[model samples]
Target: MSRSLVIAPQWIGDAVMTQPLLRRLHARGERLTVGAVPWVAPVYRAMPQVEQVLEFPFQHGGLQWGARRRLGRELHGRFDTAYVLPNSLKSALLPFLASIPRRVGYLGEARVGLLTHRLKNPQDKPPMVAFYSALSGEREGLEQDRPVLRLDAREIDAALAAQGLRRGGYLVFAPGAEYGSSKRWPVEHYAALAASLQQPVLLLGSGKDTPVCEAIAAAAPNCRNLAGHTSLAQAFALIAAARAVVSNDSGLMHVAAAFGVPQVALFGSSSPLHTPPLNDAARVVWLKDDPGYQPPLDCAPCFARECPLGHHRCLRDVRPERVAGLVQGAVSSA
Candidate 1:
């Protein structure tokens, strides 16, 4: 098998979307080892196609050239090819430094010469999953391929135990969106939904989400806030074991989709048409698609971190009752 190094994307959602691309490589007899920053490393562990995950020591922003060089030297002669996922110039630097015989990625951010085999950036943006899968140089089925992640049942059980959770006994409320408030459904809406549900609701996210999760937990006695308390591995196991999940268009939403857990994905300033949860079990709630939602959200999918219009009608218009109904149905059937 040809050994390959995958330079993973920095953002958690983007990292999860790359799974389909990795799968394509693994199917062709490529042994995959992923290079990821600390935060994204956990998701790669859940990918069965990946043989190893090398967590980079570099912090966010800047080149961190010396560190990259050291890691690249350590990886030298270990891989035959490198697939760089991000479009930024810095993302392609390690593979070039490592002297991997073949390096492939989309050309962008003036890193033209860094990659040995570069694909032109598509003029029109494509779904992130397809964008990454193209790095495999296989065009067929790119759009149809969905990301999948797996954890052994024992691992799932242990994670649940640590969180004081039982399999399929709780619902997950991932109310925080890393992109910004524009992508997050109203916190009050989440609390309202949890209050009406009989099942326990576990709020999960990064440290930044603690305040938001805590607020929701306070409003709903049925909700337990675990944000920033559990490792990403535990979070993954929790999503995998959830009876159903109610989440914004965030990384954990993608995680729930990958696990094939029943989910209600809320999209606001971001468009689901672009980064949708590519799972059969997911139901997307986007007001932009609802014609009856007057005056229609033409400004929707502004892709802004914050709503420019002051009123976030896109998500604000999507009532908690609607989301709660979907979750209730999902739980009943599951």
Candidate 2:
């Protein structure tokens, strides 16, 4: 049997987008193992096709030379091929050190010698999922088709009960973006949108987003904050059960897309074309020219730790009513 190991992306959204590649690999009849961070392990564990999951030690800080060497020794003789999804130079080092014969990944950072099969990134890849699917040797071209994520039925049921959600339909909103406040929509705006939802609003995010979710929930009594409560798998299950999801351009938005849930993804600083949600049912809302708004002087979208402009107009300018309208339309259509 052909044994293969695939290194998963660290971010939850990137991992969700890489599912098509995972499914493609599974169809090839290879014994598959996934290497992922502890936080994202729950998400991969839910994937039926994945046979094994190896955790990267937190002590390594992701690039500890000794840790990489030790992991390599343990992984030796385990797999014939390895596919790395992340572009970091360190990501390639683990499997390379493990001495996996065939290493596949995008031609990034001039690691041509390290990867045995390097595929050039596709041109004009609109949806992020299409770009990831191209990396799988089994898939020939960019598949513009909507991405799909399957969850265990039991888990979905448990998620619904945990959130008190029902089939009558509900909205899921994520107002946090881990990168920085620049990527996050205003909290008050999310509260306004939640109050307008036709059904109960389910708020989702990590521990960092607790404050935002709490404020939104307080403003809209019908809203429930599930931030810091659900595991990654539970988050996916919840998104799958929702009629629609309204979110800032973050990982949960990607999860909403993967589950084919209708979504309105608010974007600021980040370009929608580069990383739009991968669901056909989703639409991206970005700010256009407004006379009062001045262009961010310090190279906005620098993907920085903080917004250089004291005022985060990129996200602040997007009105709550507009987002609510989109949510209404998405849920109505569904």
Candidate 3:
């Protein structure tokens, strides 16, 4: 079998969306190894198609040309092909440095010369699963590909045990959006929904999410704020075992989708059309489609970090009762 090196995307959601692409490559008789940063390494670990994951030490920005060169030297001639998932110029640099015979990626950031095979970025923002699957050189049926992920039962059990919980016994609420407040459903709304849920609500996120999760937990007695308290592996394990999940269009939302957990994904400044959770059990809530809503959102999908109009009505207008109904209905049916 030919060896293929997959350069993973930095964001957790994007990493999960790449699973379909990985599946395509794996189905074609390629032994896949993913190169990822520590933050998203566990995501690839959950993908059964990935043979191994090599954690890169590179930080967020700047080329770090010296570091890429050294790693490239170490990896020279070890792979038959390379798949660069991110469009950034830096993302494709390492493969070029390694002299990987075949590098596949999109035409991005003037990286025309870095890749041996390249696809044009779609004129329209397509579903993320389809966007990544194009890297496999298949253009048809892109929308039908759904990402799937698996976690060890023991790990899920361990994560629940540590939290004094059990599989399917609690709901996971991811209330923070790394992108900014624009995508987040209001904390007050989250608290109201958590209070109404029959099962315990476990709030999960990074350190940056601590404040919002804390406020939600404080407002609802059944909610436990675990933000910043659990490792990413622990977070994934918890989400995998959750009875259901309620989150913004963030990484954990995609995690739940990949695990096939029933989830309600709320979108505000973002559009679900582009990155909707690729799971049959997932329900997306974006007011952009609601025609009856007064003072309709014309600025929706602004894709801005902060709401340009200073009123996140796109999200805030979505009442807690609406989401509570979705969760309760799914939970009871489950």
Cα lDDT of all candidates, in order?
0.91, 0.79, 0.92
Give lDDT: candidate 3, residue 115.
94
Model 3, runs deviating above 4 Å: none
lDDT of 1 at 267: 94
lDDT of 2 by residue, 14-90 (tens): 88777777777788888889999888776677677789988887443446889889999999988999998887778
Residue 59 shift from truth in candidate 1, angstroms: 1.0
- Alpha-carbon deviation at 7 in model 3, angstroms: 0.4
Residue range 186-248, candidate 3, lDDT tens digits: 989999898777569899999999999999989999999999999999999999999999999
User: lDDT of candidate 3 vs native?
Assistant: 0.92
Model 3 clash count equals 0
Clashing pairs in model 1? none
Ranking by lDDT: 3, 1, 2
- In terms of TM-score, which candidate is stronger, 1 or 2? 1
TM-score per candidate, chains pooled: 0.98, 0.87, 0.98
lDDT of 1 by residue, 1-334 (tens): 8999999998888988999999989999999999999999999999999999999998888899999899889989999999999899999999999999999999999998899998998887579899989889998999898989999999899999887778888999999999889998888889888988767999999999999999999999999999999899889999999999999999999999999999999999988878999888888898888877898888977999999999998988888888888887765665
